[model samples]
Structure formats: structure tokens, C-alpha cells
Target: MKKLVSLLWAVTLLAALALSACSSNQATEALTGGDENLSLDKEFGGFGGGDESPGFGDPELMNDSPEDAQVSDVIADEPAVIDAMSSDSPVKAFFLRITWGLLEGDSSATEVIDWSGSAEVSRGTLLVLRTIRFEGNDFVHLPRDSRQKVEFTSQTKRHFDGLLLAIIDNDTTASDTDATDGTFTFVAGSFSKVLNFSELDSLDLLEPVGDMGNEVSIVTRAKDIVPFAGGFFAGRWVKTRRDGGEFKGRWINSLGTNTGFLRGIWGINRFGNKVFKGKYISANGEFRGLLAGQWTFTRGDRAGVFEGRWVNRQHKTVGRLKGHFRTGRAGDRRGHFEGRYRVTHRENAEGSDS
Candidate 1:
């Protein structure tokens, strides 16, 4: 009976070992596709077609790491993006123009005073007034064909105060009734609007034209709505330097969009005199002219001013330029210059100073 019990125990042991060996071979075959040459690491590396292999104790499917979670949280905390071209952006410059219009009055003595000009008001602020008519009349009559243009810049913390008008009339008698039918165009930064005199009342208010949201306010009175007879312009000297420096700026015309660009170089000659020379290129770069000017130092060469003339290829003067500049330090190569350029002779082209 003892020998039979030992035999049974031995057989059971052998069966258990055989079953374990079979299970191990099946697992290896599943991992390596029955390729004995393939190592466990190489089989695992190709698992799921991924370059990496899971560690012995790692989870089959991984979650995002702590660093990835932190990055996602940071992204969620960011503020919404703002549009750069939105109306809320600050305006840098502006141009306004009044086309042909007429002012009618009850009596023959009704007069129309027409004028257009540009001015530099307050540092860095350019005010251009094209043909704006202030008439001593009762009503404005605008024809269907007339048009106008207006533009201006906006400040972050400041508002446009008002326009200053100086009406000079030498004759007492009323001038021949100026044409009354016209329109006006206004531009403030990216905001632009064209309004006819007929669409406006004696006192019209124009605002919120470009989704500006109360940022701009324009009031039109009866007398201020006459046709533009002449040309007026104003622009800032964007960049100017004295004593061997570059001179560059934009010249806005009465029509508002007929912009011209001036680029030149200035330096002191062997005689110690400051001189500048450059060219005036139209906005489209089709028209061009020559510019030459002299710089006169007022503050002992530290701060000074300049004046010059722009001429056609024939050497005939078409406009005048005058501006002031001040260097931050003694012997500094660059200076802050601001001035005005007036067109004396109108050119034939569209961008030739109106």
C-alpha cells in the first residue's frame, strides 16, 4: 500500500510540471508569433505598433502625465484673444475733406467762405482741414454727385476736443454764390464714412460710424456744410533727422486718400551748413518729385528747425516745407522733427497735393 501511494504522488507531480511548461510555451508563442528568434523585448516593442514598450509593472493604457495636466490647466486660464483691427484700437492719424457743395440764403448778401489747410496742433497731433465752408447762410444744398472724405486718429486716454476755424474775409460784399451741392468724407483710423449734405439736418450728429461705440462724436452745423472750393492739408513729419540723417514723412491731401510720401537724406556740408535732399513719392509710387531743405539750429545746434522746397523735375517749386527738430543729447545723430508742407502749385496728377 505504501508503494502505490508514492507512485500516485510522483505521477501527479509530473502532470503538474507538464501543464506549466505548456502554458509558458503558449504565452511565448502569442508574444513572438511563434518566431523563436524574436526576443521578449523586441516583441513587446512592436506591440500596438508603438515605438515604446510597457514596463513589467506598468498599466496597459496610460493616462496623461502630471506635466501634461499642468499645461492644459495653464491653457485654460489664459484670457480670450483680442482683435488688433477692432474699433477699440487707438487711432494714429486722421484726414477730412469736403467736396463740392453749395450754401443758399434768403438774401443776395449771403456769402460762402471756403478754405482748406493743414496744421500741427499740440505735439504729435496733426489736424488737416480741407475745403470746409463756413457760410453765413440758412441752408446747405448738396447735389447728388458731390462727395466728401474725413479721417482722424484716436488716443488711448484722450478725446478729440474740437476744431478751430479762422475765417478771414476782406471784402464786405457777398461773393458770388458758391456752388452748394456737395458731400463730405471723414476717416478716423480704420473708420471711414461719406455723408451727403442733403442727408444731414441743419445740426447733424454723426457717431458710432464704425462700431466705435461712443468713441467719436462729429457735429455738423448749417454753416459748416458748404462745398469745398479750395484745398487744405495737414500731416505730421513721421520721421526727420538733422546732421546726416534720413527725412521721411507722409503728406495727406484735401481728398483724404491722395497721400504722398517724402523720403530723403540730410547732412552738413564741408562749410558746416545743414542741408537735406530727398524725393516725394506718391502713395502708389507713380508720381515723384524732388525735395531740398536747410536746417537752422535754434538751441545752439542741440535743437533747431528746417525749411525747404519741393519741386518738379523742371526745378519749379510746387510746395514749401517747414519743421522743427530737437536732439535728445548733444551731438546726437537723430532728433525729433515736426513741421508742415504746403502745396503752392497744384500738380496734374491725383496725388499732386490735391
Candidate 2:
């Protein structure tokens, strides 16, 4: 009887040990994705996990490690997170109509032309305006009886002394026809003009053109200049890993006054390229705009160069940015960057009037 009892106890002890071993194996598999060679210790070490793990601060982690290269390859195969342009909607814009003869080189004259015909102007007709000398174009949608304003860049105002505005009817089945075209000098104080379509040879035909009217009204205005410094910018950046980082810097004008501050983020995309984006605000925190660009670095290198453009909220390229950065220690998150920026002027920057 004593021998039988001992045998029963031995069986129970063996069964409990087997059950515990199975549970332990399952938990290990769950943590290591069932890979016999991989472990939580190895993976976490690369990210500063354990005392035995070599952190990113180690130059070997960036250069000689096959594991790091494999990780980069995996990331490069992923899809992009950010596109070149953030928005695609049409910007708010205004329209202006000025008569033919009244635009004749007079800066201060305010003569309105009278027409007898009450022709109706259709919506969706394209109005094309350009400077004869400068290489910029403005396309506006025509709305009946509405006075709209035109925007000119400081560069356009300084370079092009004259303006030519034209109306075109775009036809899908036929060639586009010109309804009216006029040339006039742009004066600063005068924003309103009466454009007479009757003066155009296209409007003089006996046959009524596609939505061609006897007259239309147009106006032109200059954008208010906001005083800000433009020149070189210098700043520092830091990252927890190759995939995410932040940077901050100061920009100055030609006079070397600390005009504004810039702060933004940097990251490595799926393609393995380093991309960064940020915004600049005036010292008073009043004026603000966006900037974006990429970093060019060689494999295994601790330093690299970068270049990109700065744009307004409208996504118009207003300035340029270029700089370089250097990493500190094997786990250091800090780096430095410096670059220059220049703001460009435009008469009609791409954006909505709203």
C-alpha cells in the first residue's frame, strides 16, 4: 500500500512539471515572435533598452551593424507619410475690369467708359492676365457684376511697369476665343478701373461671341508689405531615433537683427531619406510661415547636408533653406544646423482671396 501511494504522488508531480513547461514556452514565443534566434533583449537594446544593449550613440550602431541596415531596409520599403504639398484647393482670388481707352498711361486718371449693350457675362469663363515683360500669369474665374481685386508681388511691381488683362472663353469642342484684352499702367493709389470690352476687335464683330459682353469691370491692388528680416538662419536639432526629431533656430535680416524663430520636426521616411519640416515666426510671434526639405547623408556617416524651400501658408515658395548637421555621442540626441533664406516677391501669389 505504501509503494502504491508513492507511485501515485510521483505521477502527479511529473504532470505538474510538464504543464508549467508548456506555459513557459508559450510566453517566450509570444514575446519573441516565435523566432528562436530573436529575443526581447536584442531588439530592445538597439533602442536603449538594457544595460548590455549598445545604444544609438554607438557609432557602430549606425555604421557597421547588419541589424541596423536590415531595419533601414524594412523602413525604406514602407509607404511615404507626408507629401510635397499639404493642400490642393484653389485659393481665394478677386477680379477687376477696366475699360480700353481709360488705361492709356495715366496713373491718376479715373475715367469710366459708358456702353449701350447690356450683355450678360457667364460664370466659369476664364480671365487671363499677365505682365508683358515679366513671366507670370494669373487666371481668374468670371462672376457677373462682381468687382474683384488683383494681387501683385513686390518683384512684379518693381520689374513690370505695365499690365495687360484679357478674357478668354474656353470651349471643349472649339478653339478658345478672346473676348477682350487691354493694356494699362498700374498706379499705387488707384485700385478701380472700368474695362470696356467693346474696344477689342473680337468684341466688335456683328455676331455675338460666347458670353462676350459689351463691357466688364476689373480692379487691381498691391499686397501690403510686411516688414521682416531675410537672410541666414542657424539652429540646433535633436532626435530620439532615426525616425523622429525636432529642430529650432533663429533667422536674421541683412542688418543682422534677430528677427524671428523657427521650430519644426525631422524624420526618416520609408525611402530611408531624412526629411524635415518646420515653421518660422517673428520675434514677436506675429508672422508665421512653413519650411520643408531633405537631409543628404552617406551611409555610416555622422554628419550630412540638407536643402529645401520655405513657403507661405498659400504654399507659394517664398524662400530657400540649406544647411548641415553633426551628431554628438553614441547615444547623444543633439545636433547643429545652419543655412540661408531669401524671400521672393510676386504680384499674384497662388492662393484664394479668402
lDDT of 2 by residue, 46-138 (tens): 111111212213342223111100111121122321110012212111222222221112233343222211212232222323222223442
* Per-model root-mean-square deviation over C-alphas: 32.8, 25.7
lDDT of 2 at 296: 60
Model 2: CA > 4 A from native: 1-229, 298-300, 330-333, 346-354
Candidate 1 residues lying further than 4 Å off, grouped into runs, are: 1-242, 254-258, 300-302, 329-335, 345-353
Candidate with the greatest TM-score versus the true structure: 1
Per-residue alpha-carbon lDDT of model 1 for 219-325, expressed as tens digits?
33221111221222222222222234443445443233334454444555435566666566654454445667787656554445677776665667676666554
How many residue pairs clash per model?
29, 24
lDDT of each: 0.36, 0.37
